[model samples]
Target chain A: MAESVSEVRAWVNQRRGEGRTIGLVPTMGFLHDGHLSLVKRAKAAGHAVVMSIFVNPLQFGPGEDYDRYPRDIARDRKLAERTGVDLLFTPSVEEMYPRALQVTLRVGDLANRLCGLSRPGHFDGVATVVAKLFHIVEPDEAFFGEKDYQQLRIIQTMVEDLNLPVKVIGCPTVREADGLAMSSRNRYLSPEERRRAAVLSRALFDAARRCREGTTRAAELVQSVTQQLSSAGLEVEYVSAVREEDLGQVDQIDQPCRLLAAVRVGETRLIDNVALEAGKGMGHVSAYVDR
Target chain B: MAESVSEVRAWVNQRRGEGRTIGLVPTMGFLHDGHLSLVKRAKAAGHAVVMSIFVNPLQFGPGEDYDRYPRDIARDRKLAERTGVDLLFTPSVEEMYPRALQVTLRVGDLANRLCGLSRPGHFDGVATVVAKLFHIVEPDEAFFGEKDYQQLRIIQTMVEDLNLPVKVIGCPTVREADGLAMSSRNRYLSPEERRRAAVLSRALFDAARRCREGTTRAAELVQSVTQQLSSAGLEVEYVSAVREEDLGQVDQIDQPCRLLAAVRVGETRLIDNVALEAGKGMGHVSAYVDR
Candidate 1:
């Protein structure tokens, strides 16, 4: 475990110098099964896995719970080691933003939809910090979970636009047995809220099933998902079908699409998404959605 | 010479596979002695040099001379060959920006002063394009001429703030016999404007001398240099003393400083700077200024 940026660079460089490829799993601490799945995928690919645990304050908005974001260094360390993580980087805020950040990296259009509509400046913060980590780690490939579907697409766009050398590998979204997507913020839910949080995924899975059942209209899918969540006593923030590529809103599901939604269950917010295949819609629904 | 980003990357990666270090010299074509000096420095340091010549539209304001920027691939190729440049990257606008630029990279306080004041969005364009080039080239060291002193500082800050792995080397500003700084835009000056352009450097060199001779007040030094520029029948844009690192306007020359000025002779705008050593400022003036 290294807490300093320079130390981690030295470790990664030493391994690279010896011709070993590196795979990075970037996460905010409080390790969940979803994060470990990425680590497992990295190790499975014969990469010396480096998992970064930085609760990046940049990705949280002013009103968001940056201060209350979950953190447990000791537990996180144990979880990472158990998952066969080769190195763990936990840098302090001072180490990351030593001075006021003057550089603002804003990815247009793609960031203004989905989660970005409610939490502005979130993906810019994500892109900037991710860019910093990419430079610091210089990994051949980096892993991300599909639970942050918008975030994964944004990073992919940023990498393509910037011509970044690293390949982005997005793993499947790990979920609870009841269908709630596993997330670091899942801990913020109350016992009852946790039970209701499953509705977010359930609603999306239901809508995805409707799409597979020959429902072509995006409005119909959105209306069905919104009704399902509202009936479950969740405040629906946004329920829409967007193209998997640029996240553009799709009126008719003619292509591979991502049915995404965000909802407020009590004071906690939960987001989940499921991929809908274009032609063989129902054939792959079971793979993306946990039954 | 490679005209596309992919071709250049392929060539660079092939060299990297053989363990050869690369040094990048990024420029707008009209190959000057200043650029060749960078190539010489790179080769002197045992690096294979890749020089890029693209008149980036992003670095130009809407009304700036991006369209009229000097470009001559034939002459540039001859000069680069004479200087022993290993490769030349001259990507077109379409190649560099395949789509509308969704990502905007803005360097805060550092980019909002000096040259940035007159030409808004210039440094943002510079920062963004440079970032793209950095990713594409993946150079071990990148070179910039100190003639654009504020630009040099801005790029340094960007690299440091972003934790970019490449080292930024600021080469001494190459000057003409009459002390005019070499720039591709210098060709914009009429022969008569060219004669008076030397006054920009002379005024800065003179102020730097006064600072060494115990002229401590920044306002006094600015006044003297401004008067010199105005007396030469040039329309002075600005003449100020600033701390070297941040370009913050300084009140007293108590530390290492820069005396910078911008002026317009007829329709041509020119800029020059002189670095002042804290106690003995004039000690290094001749290296940056021509007699």
Candidate 2:
């Protein structure tokens, strides 16, 4: 485990000297299955896996969860080591940003959609910190979970736009047996809210299944998912269907699109998404749901 | 000259394999002594020097000189080879930005003063393209002239803020025989304007001399420089003395500071700057002015 930028940089330099390819998996801590899956994927793809555990303050809003964001270095370190992560970087916030970062990175209209609607500047913060991580690690490829679909898309676009030398690989979202997508914020849920959150994933899978059954209208799919969350007493923020490639709007889904939703179950906000092609049901739905 | 990004990237990779350190000199064509000096400095410091000649469209304003920006590729190629540049990258704008670039990078307040004040969104465009060049070239050190002092500071700050791997080197401003700073836009000047523009460099030097003679007030230096430009039949835009490092306002010049001025000699906008320590009268004034 490296706690300083210079230390991790020296380690990376040494690894690069040995001609080893590196993969980066960036996350806020608390060791969820989703983050671990990214680490496992990185290890499989690149010779060296470096997992960075940082609760980037830049990504959080004023009233957001920056202060209470879950963190457990001991648990995260163990999980990373078990998953064959070669380096675990946990730099302090001060170390990451000795002075305030004045440079702003925005992805235009792409960042103004989906999760970006309610969480303004969220993706910009994510993009900035992710860039910093990529530069520091100098990885050949970076791994991200499809659970945050919009985030995954924004990162992919940023890499392409800036011609960053890192390939962005989106791993499938890891989930729980009870049909709830794994998230560090899942720890904030009470027992009742935890059970209710299962509806979030179930709704997405059901919507994807419907799309496979020829309900190709994006509006119809969005309405179906929104109704399910509402029926389960969840406050639906947005249930959007956007073209999977660039997150562009999709009126009639002729190709692959994504069904994404953010809802409030009691006090915790939960998000889940699944890709829908006309003939393809949820690609890995069976892993999350009994059906 | 390597005309494609892939070609230059391949050449860079080959050099890295041989343990050669690379330096990058970015420029807009129309080879001048200013740009050649940067190439020479890069070759001296690093094992290999790569020069990129691209008139970046992103940095130009709507009514700016982008369309009329000078270009002489044949001459530029000869000069680059003559200076012993290891690689010359001259990628077309299309190759650099295949799609409309959506990622926007800005250097905040640092970009809102001086040239930035006159040219809104200009530095943002510069920061974005410079970042692209750095990523594509991956040079150990990148060179720029201090004639664009604000731009140099902004790039240096952006690099530190983003943890970019390249070291930014600021070389002294190259000057013409009669004390006119070398700029690609100098070709636009008429004979009279060309002769009169030497006043810009002269004013900066005179102000520096005054500071060294114990006139250490920033306001006094600014007034003296502005007076010199106004008397020379030139349109003075701004004359400011700021702390050399951050371009912060310097009320009392107890430490090193910079005197920057921008003006219009007929139709061409020319800018010049000089550094002033309490007793250092324009460290390189002997080269630019008749002392």
Query: What stretches of model 1 exceed 4 Å from their correct place?
Result: A278-281, A286-291, B286-291
RMSD of each: 1.6, 2.0
Please write out the lDDT profile of model 1 over residues A1-291, one tens digit for every residue.
Answer: 998889999999899888899999999989988999999999999999999999999889888999999989999999999989999999999999999887768879999888989999899999999999999999999999998999999998898888888999988988789878888899889898888888888788777777778887999989998998999899999987999889999999998888888999888888888886544555655435342
TM-score of each: 0.97, 0.97
lDDT for position B235 in model 2? 99
Considering just the first chain, candidate 2 attains a TM-score of 0.96
TM-score of chain B alone in model 1: 0.97
Give the per-prediction TM-score of chain B: 0.97, 0.96
Q: Pairs clashing in candidate 2?
A: none
lDDT of 1 by residue, B1-291 (tens): 998888998999999989899999999989989999999999998888999998989888877788888889999999999998999998989999999776768888887788889998899889899999999999999999998888899889989888889999999999998888999889999898899888888888888888787888989989999998999999998887899868999998888788888889998888889876556734767447332
Q: Report model 1's TM-score to 2 decimal places.
A: 0.97
Residue range with the least summed lDDT across 10 consecutive positions in model 1 chain B: B282-291
Model 1 residue A156 lDDT score:
89
